[model samples]
Target: MKTLTKEMQAAITPDMALDLLKQGNARFVNNLKINRNLLQQANETSDGQHPFAVILSCIDSRTSAELIFDQGLGDIFSVRVAGNIINEDILGSMEFGCKVAGSKIIVVLGHTKCGAIKGACDHVEMGNLTALLTKIRPAVDEELTITENRNSSNPEFVEKVSEINVKRTVRSIVERSPILRDMIKAGEIQIVGGIHDITTGVVQFHEVESL
Candidate 1:
C-alpha cells in the first residue's frame, strides 16, 4: 500500500522480502490488491528508489511482475527477458541491484506457456532471437523425462523445461556474479526461482534456495 523507503528496505531480511512477494501475489490472485496513489508513490520515489528485491522475469505481456506482485512504484527492481534467461549484462544489473542498490532478494521468474521456452523446445530461429533462445536450449536438453513429445506443443514438456530454465537461471546468477554470491554468502541477499501460471495469475515459487 505504501511505497518502499530506505529504512523499510534496510529493515527487511532476505526471507522477509520473499514472503512479502508471496503475500502480494496472493493478494493479486484473490483480487485483494491494496490501494496506493500511484502519483504519490511516483513523487515519493522521484529523487531516489530503495527497492527491496530484484525480479528477473519474462517479456510476456501477461506476466508483468509489479502487477502480479501488487507492488507500488519503488517497491522492487524489475529485469525482464524472454525465457528469463541469464547473461553477462543481466548478471551485472543484478549485481548493481543487490550490491550497489541494496536490494535483498534476487528472483528468477519463469512462466508457464512461455513462448521463448516453446521456441527453445522446437529450436525456433530468427534474427537476434535465435541467439537469445539458444540460452534456454540447455534446459530443454536437461529435461530428459518427457522423451515422447519433446516439442512445445506437448504441454508437459514445455512446463518441465520452463521450470528447469528458472532453476538454471537462479544457479547462473549465483555462479556468474561474485558480488551477488558474496552478498548471499554474507546473508545479505537470497536467490530463488518461481513459475507464473498465465491462466491462474499465480506465481508458484520453487522450494530450492540457491544461496
Candidate 2:
C-alpha cells in the first residue's frame, strides 16, 4: 500500500473516504492486510501529511483505528479518548483535522466491552476520571430501555449506552463546532458513528448524513 499524498487526499470524496475505511476494515477482518514499508512511508510523509479522514475512537487497546482500518502512515488521523465523548478540545481537534487539514470525513467510533462506558454505567469515580465520566452521563441517561439493571455488570445495558454514546458524540460534534457544521452543510465533510466489535473486529457503522 502506498502512503497518502496531498493530491490523493484532495481527490478523495467524503463517500470515497468512507469506502476506503470500509475496505480497510474488511481487509483487517480477513487478515489480508496490505504490505507496505513503514520506513518508506514515514520518509515519504516526513514533510507533510494529507490524511483523508479523522476518526475519534475510544482508548481501547483492541480498537486501534490504524490497524483495524488497515491504513498506512498518513492515511488517516486517529483521535482517541475514553468513551469517545465530545468536548471543546476534541471539537477543536476535529476542526483542525477537517477544516485546516483537508480531511474529508469525521467518524465517532465506539466499541463493545469498552471500559470507559462500563465506568460511566456504574458511575465509577476516580480523581480526574470522574470528570471525564461525567461527560458520558447523558448517554447513560438516554438509554432508558433497560431501567431494571443499568449498571456495568449488565452487558446489554452497557452495550446500549455505548451505542447511544457514539451517536450522541456524532451529533454533538456538528452541534458544537460551527466550522465542522458549515463544512458538513457544504458537503466538504461528512460525519458518522460506528461500534467496533472487539471479538469479531467488525465496525458496524451508523450513517448520519447531517446532524
Candidate 3:
C-alpha cells in the first residue's frame, strides 16, 4: 500500500478513520498483512511523513501501534509513554499531528496486562515514575468495582482500570487541547480509545460516544 497523501488524510471522516483501523487490525489478526517492500517504504517516506493517525500508546513491548495496526512507515505517528497518559507535551504532539501534520485520527491505546497500568493499580511510587503514574490514579480511583482486590494482581480490576484509563486519556486530550477540540467539533479530526489484549492480539475499540 502507498503512504497516505494530504488529500487522502483530509478526506477521511471520523467514521472512516475508525473503520480503517478496524480493518487493519482485522488483517493483522488473520495474518493477511499487506505485502510491502519495507526498504522502498523507507525511501518513499524519507523526504517527509504523512501519517494518517496519531497513536498514544504505552511503552509495552507487546503493543506497538504500527505492528498491531498493520501500518507501514509514515502510516502513523506514535506517541508513547508509560500508562499512555496525556500531558502538555503529548497534547502538543497530538496538536502537531492532527492540525499541522494532517493526521486524521488520534487513538489512545491501552492494553491488558500493561505494566504501567499495574503500577498505577498498585500505587507503586518510584522516583520520577511516581509523578507519571499519578496521571492514571484518577482512573484507578474511579473504578468502583472490585473494591476488595484493588491491586494490580487482581486481573479483573486491572483490566477495568485500564479501560477507564483509555477513556480518561481521550477526554483529557480534548479538554487539554483547544486545537484538537475544534478539529473534532469541525469534523476535521477524531479521537478514540481502545484496549489491546496482549495474549490474543486483539484491540477492542471503546464506543465512539464514550470517547
lDDT against the true structure, per candidate, is: 0.92, 0.92, 0.89
Over all chains combined, what TM-score does candidate 1 have? Answer: 0.98
Per-residue accuracy of model 2 over 175-199 as CA lDDT, tens digit each: 8888999999999999999999999
Which 10-residue window in model 2 sums to the lowest lDDT?
202-211
39-67, model 1: which lDDT tens digit per residue? 99999999999999999999999999999
Runs of candidate 1 with Cα error greater than 4 angstroms are 208-211
lDDT value for model 2: 0.92
Clashing pairs counted in every model: 0, 0, 0
Looking at candidate 2, what is the lDDT of residue 179? 95
Count backbone clashes in candidate 1.
0
Candidate 3: give the clashing pairs: none
> Cα RMSD to native, each candidate?
0.9, 0.8, 1.4
Cα RMSD of predicted structure 2:
0.8
TM-score of 2: 0.98
